[model samples]
Target: MKTERPRVAIQGIRASFHEEAALRYFGENIETVECNSFKQTFEALQNKEADYVVMAIENSIAGSILPNYSLMMSYSFPVVGEVYVPIQLHLMALPGVRFDDVKYVTSHPIAIRQCIDFFDEYPRLQIVESNDTAACAKRIRDEQLTDTVAIANALAAQLYGLDVLERRIESNKLNFTRFLILTTHENARKKTGANKASLCFQVNNEVGALAKVLNIFAHENVNMSKIQSMPVLGKRNEYNFYVDIEWGETRQFDNAIKQILKYTHNFNILGEYLKYEEDTQAPKPAPSPESTKRYITVRKIE
Candidate 1:
């Protein structure tokens, strides 16, 4: 009997970076349940429409997505895994559309911002912001807009049958977005190599309260990889701290958690899973001849 493919919920349509991260984590055999917003992704998982959720938590260029942190606290789902996708923005349009023929360029606001240096030189092109990078590419293809181009990924160009006008056009080549793989508590199982964990807690307002919790982790030799503070809703001067920690030994992590429970108010372990290491090297440009043709013909705007 054939095995059933895992269904993953991601915040965007097909061929999006969210989908890219999902594929990287779960592989291409999984089915993608597209969602319009991050909250919707969680809802899908909550409603049993998806087996897992791939949600972007932070970006190297734009920093942490604060709203997602609130969502995590709201739903209280377990983050079972993680994947890092390099933010490689490409310019793509209908087949046979020349570089000089492009009049308008569109993409997600964040994607557009990353490619500002490239667009700064071309004052003739109008910049339009959309909700998803892949959605922009799909619109250009579905509408057959010859004069318009989209700033998206190579996957979008391939999926929509659009030709890549320019590859790796984003201003920052080193940019990357970290996505978390989340599932319902019942479906979450500890992986064999689980060495990292995500935790959130509330500490007393008194001075040294937060420091004491940190000292426990330090005392147990658990390395705190990341710490983010989010304001408790409708509660002034109160904050929830989200922390990611890695450990060399499971006993150290267990001991740290035991000690932290004494100092924290609403301590919650979001998940315990393998940590993903980001690739520092920039992605190579697309090797297609058509993708590189614009480099020789288009004059630098400056």
Candidate 2:
């Protein structure tokens, strides 16, 4: 019997970075359930409409998406895995459209922010923020807007049949977005070879309370990769600490958790999964001469 493909939910339409992350984690065989917002993706998982969810947790250029942390706490889904996608924004338009013909540029707000340096050079072009980068590209194709262009990924250009007019337009070439693979508790199983975990807890406002918890992990030889503090709702001067930790042995993590519980309240183990590591030493190609020239000329447009 043939196995049914997993239905994955993502916070954007097809050809989006969310969909790209899902494909990276689950392969191309999964079905994508598009959601207009991040909350909607969790709702899909909550309603059993999707077997899994791929959500962007952080971006190299934009920093942490704070709202996602709250969503993770609210829904309490298990993060089964993670994937980091290199973000490469391109300016695309309808076929036969020239660069000079572009009057308005549009994309997701985050995508627009990433390309601010490129847009700063051309003040004559109106910048508009839309819901999704791929959606903007689709609109350009569906409406046949010759005077408008969308700042999105190459995948969007390819899927929407739009021609890329400018490549790698993002200000930072090293941009990357980290996405988390989440699922309901019933479907979540500890990943094989798991070495990292995400946890959240609250400690007393007293001095040394927070440090005491960190010290426990340190003494256990657990490597704390990241720590973030979020304001506890309706509470004064109290915060919830979210941490990501890694270890070589599972006992180290278990022992650390046991010790920290004494100093923490409402502690929750969000998930444990294999950590994703990118090859940072890989050489990146320099921008093409044509692209450099386009940047210089576009700067003089105004």
| Candidate 2 whole-model C-alpha lDDT, 0 to 1 | 0.84
Q: What is the C-alpha lDDT profile of model 1 across 1-302, one tens digit per residue?
A: 11277778888887789877876676546667888788888888887888888999999999999999999989999999888888989999999999998999999999999999999999999998999999999999899999999999887887788998889999989998999999988888999978999999999999999999999999999999999999898999999999999999999999999989999988899999988854532333332334323221211111
lDDT of 2 by residue, 1-302 (tens): 11277878888787788877776676656677878789988988897778888999888878888999999999999988888889999999999999897899999898999899999998989998998998999899899999999998877787778899999999999999988999988888997878999999999999799999989989999999889899999999999998999999999998999999999999999899988865632222322334323321110000
lDDT (CA) per prediction: 0.85, 0.84
Off by over 4 Å in 1: 1-3, 278-302
Q: For each of the candidates, give the backbone clash count.
A: 0, 0
Clash pairs, model 2 backbone: none
